[model samples]
Target chain A: MINNEVTKLLNMTYPVIQAPMAGGVTTSELVAAVADNGGLGMMGAGYMTSSQIREQIREIQQLTEGPFGINLFVPNEFHVSEQEVELASNRLQPIREQLDLQQKEQVDIPNFDKVSESFQQQIEVVIEEKIPFCSFTFGIPSKEIIEELKQHHIILIGTATTVKEAVENEKAGMDMVVVQGCEAGGHRGNFLSGDQESLIGLMALIPQVVDNVSIPVIAAGGIMDGRGLMAALCLGAQCVQMGTAFLNCEESGAHASHKEAILHAAEDETVLTRSFSGKWARGLKNDYINEMHEDESLFPAFPVQNKLSQDIRKAAAAQNKTAFMSLWSGQSPRLAKKQCVESLMEHIISETRKIGRKV
Target chain B: MINNEVTKLLNMTYPVIQAPMAGGVTTSELVAAVADNGGLGMMGAGYMTSSQIREQIREIQQLTEGPFGINLFVPNEFHVSEQEVELASNRLQPIREQLDLQQKEQVDIPNFDKVSESFQQQIEVVIEEKIPFCSFTFGIPSKEIIEELKQHHIILIGTATTVKEAVENEKAGMDMVVVQGCEAGGHRGNFLSGDQESLIGLMALIPQVVDNVSIPVIAAGGIMDGRGLMAALCLGAQCVQMGTAFLNCEESGAHASHKEAILHAAEDETVLTRSFSGKWARGLKNDYINEMHEDESLFPAFPVQNKLSQDIRKAAAAQNKTAFMSLWSGQSPRLAKKQCVESLMEHIISETRKIGRKV
Candidate 1:
């Protein structure tokens, strides 16, 4: 019903995007379904191996000729000391007991120094496939890498938590920027620091980002339906990238328990905690988080905490226990329903039109 | 441009309610001007004594025949121990020295147990005058009093920070509720433990409140214009209450420094700190707050801290030093302008129409 630069640039029928949620939730089928529905479906390559990402992209390419996107987590460099690991392990030991995990501590925690290779390999896959669109979160890529992606004629969209970060993305010559607010689910794409103080909410962050930046802006966070879409556009966002709205899509690879947890979530149930991944992420707060989220010193930074909690998360998911799984959800998770992406897309469009008629 | 139940209930042409900002900001002139322009203007009676509020109400009655609102801060009970006071005073000594205040600790702080009298007297005035609209923040009023207000045909509205708070307001028999989000400037209306974690943003808060309570919903916080009205309406809000949007209106009673600070605010500059009132509030983060906001233990409980910092706020306002003033502002403070209320209201109506044409 509405046309904008985002719809034109991404070559999609609508300005809505199925936000590329990382951590194995956004599956190839989900991407294909959203793309088939005329929204830009994004293939999340953050946790995928180079081969896995390539195969997924190939599957989507075959499923629909409609343009889609690939999302990558820009890797950060950090040193994890043995003491921090020990402290994290010790602190997590009590939580494992509470969750009744078979293992005390997760094994095979990837070393950050060695993480660059996998990240670089994934980037290579993106470049080789000549993906039409790509977005990066957690941080920004280096100038050389950005230039290489641009050389392939890929449009790069950067994620920002604050205006300062959005300006940095523009300075890096990103085609567009996603202004992710605090109400967003999963890990916060905060590159400046690990503190929660930098977390500004969407209503407050959008207008500020719009006024300061010249590039097209994509609004993300608590948006769940067409009302959210309308609100985002009113706030000056050219497009909206919604994760939670598509979180329970039938084609989504999210765990069954994750979907159920989202459906059962109340308005204020989600809490922004680093207990799951050592990075601030909003998820439906459960017994597991309440017990372990008291101290930050006990968590060993980023990938370390993310990797260490995998066993517990996996065990919880296997048993279908909502308490222990990292049910990444926005504050508006209550709005989520278990539907196919196409059906959900139809609902959003219709609802937005209904509201638009009266507006 | 838009019509809803809120406009009909409040007898306004627009679905906009000028927020009743406390701390000497919402002047009688501003209230009358906004009401005269066909919007439901609110007279902030949060800081005034019963006599002062009565005088202000009478003054506004003479200035404009249009309907307006009166806001009262529901009182809280707390006892600040000598040790807590001493600890707070000790921590504040350094900051006081920097500000060049002759005295160290402010004396004659009002007691919360005694705060009941003043709060009770204000309620008596509202009842006596048969005020058309009344709203409460910080906590819910007693049931008996709510019933009395309803008997008098007072359209009672309650302020809420979360869904639980909104439900509580409805349970107490409020006619409507104001869903104030974290993006709201001034003291958060949180009656729960005074922590910033309870602060939820507008995008995440509005829909949740709308569904949980049967009462008509008024969305507040970070809403700056008619675009905000359209968004709130789409989210199921019957009306929108905006504070920072009109803080710099020509008829506002805000200090020059206060207005200036809001006009120049950045996206992430505001912080929800207890340093100002011992109640968590969002305001432009200044050098004084930066120096003293490290630990909550360093501040005494509510009104004591509010009383302790009175001299600094007064002195800063007089000398035009924004660094030491509270400078209460919502997240979208940058959207504020030095203009008259009537003209700003007209601009908002026109802009909403322009955006509506595209939608």
Candidate 2:
């Protein structure tokens, strides 16, 4: 059951793929550990600079000789007004005071031209480093970039939150697509559909996507253990991409407090908020999310809002105050466990076999 | 895989339960067809009076000798101020005018005591009719009622939207619990968690609920075919209760426009709205939903708001105008087929066997 088109294409023993969660969650050690354990491990290059991406690829190559992947964020054109930024800054004033941090003026808002240029450089690095696999989030890359990647024999994967998005990815020549369900953590990958419409559950998402596209479908979201893996496969997905399950692993770069918050969180404790970043992401409910519930829509978009909250998140982490930090988690946090990659992979495989036999 | 504890308990050969959809969708012919085809059929007796329930039970008995179930809405104490009802009526005036419905002199608002009395009478009818299986939505019944039903050898089921609600049902002596996911159509059965918190997807809701409770879990939400059944089973559900799948059946009493809307809908076309009944329900986005979006939160609770919009919906249905009627559907409308219950059952069973043999 574990051996199929996905395994053959990715050249892995198991059909598990570690989700590339940005903001320092996917460490090279974590990626390498999963690769060594017969699963595809992906480095989250969405927020990394070209230099950082190159260095991590080298570091992972030394840790494991197995094939690994990298994921990049396709930059979307966004508008940010100065007055809106000021209003957002004023709203964060109380949180800064609570963190006892000095108020800094002139936050560096990201420029779209610079972001797009950086993405190009990141793609070049993937080709230069000869990474076996590369996945994209937010949107699909241009025809030229995809052709360039394919020229270098890099298998490209696209992230989608709807069947139309999946069809678009297939038309754009993606080798596979990860269908992110509403139960997923981190950022939502809805490009064509609105936030509310893109929230199709895995139970409905996988089959619909598979029926529309010829490429192998990878299901991502609140999948934690064997039950999720088997269910995804039964729903027509060829593989499963997990984020929260791997984020709690020992080798992950996630903060201790962030890990603990998920470890103790209930299924209903997580809520989707664009407060941390302009794009809606699922995370544990805290004081910051509650405070920004009303004003989240008024804040700047994506990289801009993410940059504005950097200092507060850093300070909160330094002080170990989880309330001010983004504690990202999927809906199935109650099933999360703090373990190593090898053990998690072993458990998923064994339990999947057990269920397959029993059913 | 089809034969399990749930099937044994329900005295059915297949692990399929036709969702007890209210509002005349679950006709006697439809229920009898499902029962005769190896699945457990259920009557949506939530809105039926004592005499209506008795008549339906007798009607279904004449159609099929197989066992079937009935679902009741547990009455909750509600307060309806005259001002609020008037305000709600004023808000709905434009829709009523659009539908050309005449304004009545006095709107008969439901009272809590009378609703409770009606529920008691309904329960007495179920007992007298010797219904083999009974289920409750919104909340659990009283302990004395459970004891009385058990003494009569009737199997009890409870609907839940979260893990805590499932545990409560088990504690209340429910023989089984149906975990309704966010992808489910119709009214949400969230008694303990808020609307937002209770919207856990089936991918996250099923396994978490299964891990917490000892009773059998029947997965519900966006399930339309054999793939959904196998996926739900893999997620630890002993059976699956489907609504939208059965709502479009040939024998179902749904309006022709309702069936056509679902048959032609896309996966992302449905959305959750409270304008129809003052309770959150997933359905196709139409004129009524779009117009009432801004004022849905201000509408009176359940039966009160449900009463306020009755005339408009009835007129729309009579005229075959889907824009004003509630075309309830799940996320996977693309998978729905306008077939008879017997053909649908045979397709599901064959697909399940094929998937089982392949996997």
- Best lDDT among the predictions, by candidate number: 2
Q: Alpha-carbon error at A322 in model 2, in Å?
A: 0.8
RMSD after CA superposition, every candidate:
2.2, 0.8
Using TM-score, give the best candidate's number: 2
True contacts kept of each: 0.58, 0.75
Question: Which digits, one per residue and each the tens of the lDDT, describe model 1 over residues B233-296?
Answer: 7788888898887888989988887888888877677887889788888888898788887775
Model 1 interface RMSD, in angstroms? 2.1
lDDT of 2 by residue, B215-293 (tens): 9999999999999999999889999999999999999999998999999999999999989888899999999999999
Q: Write the per-residue lDDT of candidate 2 for residues A1-359, one digit (tens) a residue.
A: 57899999998999999999888889999999999999999999999999999999989989999979999999999988988888888888899999999885688788899999999999999999998899999999999999999999999999999999999999999999999999999899999999999999889989989889999999999999999999999899999999999999999999999999998888999999999888899999999999999989998999899999989999999999999999999999999998999999999999999888977
**Candidate 2: residue pairs that collide:** none
Docking class of 2: high
Candidate 2 segments exceeding 4 Å error? none
